[model samples]
Target: MTQALPSLKDHCRTTVAELIRICQDRAVRSALRPLLAGIPDMQIRAMRYLPRNAPVNQDLLYLIAGLVAEYPCSLPEPNNVMSFGASLYKLSQHPDIKATGIERRLESLLQLELDSLMQPLHSLVVQFSSTQSSKTSIVIDYATLLYHLRCWDDSRKWVQLTWARDFWCPKEDGKEQNSDETLDIVKS
Candidate 1:
């Protein structure tokens, strides 16, 4: 009998818990600080938490791990419903946020190709962390971030569309409003 592989959500949940543990340990966090600087070659410290030769995008995984290490947060949402997009939406609505700044940043991020995504994304995640730090602890869905990164290269750019919807279509009465319109606008 063969063992079944865990789903991405399950894998991410486990990975996130490991990342939180790293964040809590000063020594480990210090060792992994290089990852926050986008050190591509010095991956030995990060290698232990990563899968061994899995048929997955290692670059994206490393990027996510680095981001999580840099901005430590507890995963308050359930793994299945955790959403980077939703967090961005909440950030956009933050009272301290400058709406136009976030709008422009998100627009630029959506236009970037996979190769150019890391730096801008790092900046935005940092911004998200800073903006929320004073009022509430920073929270982000690492699983959703990884999933979106993997899907970023799809021809239709569905991940981008979904992000735009999450940002623009605020929920009302326990449902999303004008999400279809937001998606259509994103498609053009």
Candidate 2:
């Protein structure tokens, strides 16, 4: 028989110290259901990249930071770069996040992720969209993601979410390359 899990309250405790480690696994422990954990790594890391750390609107910065400092996106090394950016784009809009910290870091990460992942995503979108859509289908558009990020003018925020894919891209010198991409949390 399997043992029971921990409580949700026991999981999410906002602290920069834990951000680095929890980033490896957004969902450390869950009871029987879903629970909010830590800040998305991409957003936190993104905060590191902002050219201008100036607060967008004082109150909002802290709020966003608190949220960023709290979200938990445990994506793997490479693919996570994009996943975190996207997660932040959504989270920046949250009222709590806006009241907390710098949105620029999140913005910068988003931009960076998109810049690197776009062409590949573009091709993927083209190929996938061409196929038939099932009753339940999820579509992530890499194009204009920055535009979407900028739209965090109201209540929105990125949270600890995870996604996976098998994306293929060309080598820097134009050679075709494909890898079995897993977005981090692999259910072993």
Against the true structure, whose lDDT is highest? Answer: 1
Candidate 1 per-residue lDDT, tens place, 120-151, comes to 87887877778755766546877657756776
lDDT (10s digit) by residue, model 2, range 1-188: 99776322122222212433433443321110011122344334444422233323322332323332233223223322343233333333334344123243433333343224333323322333333243422223221122233333323222111221111121232211222233112312
- Model 2, stretches more than 4 Å misplaced? 1-52, 72-150, 153-188
Name the TM-score of candidate 1.
0.76
Per-candidate local distance difference test: 0.66, 0.29
Worst 10 residues of 2 by lDDT: 29-38
Best by TM-score: 1
TM, every model: 0.76, 0.19
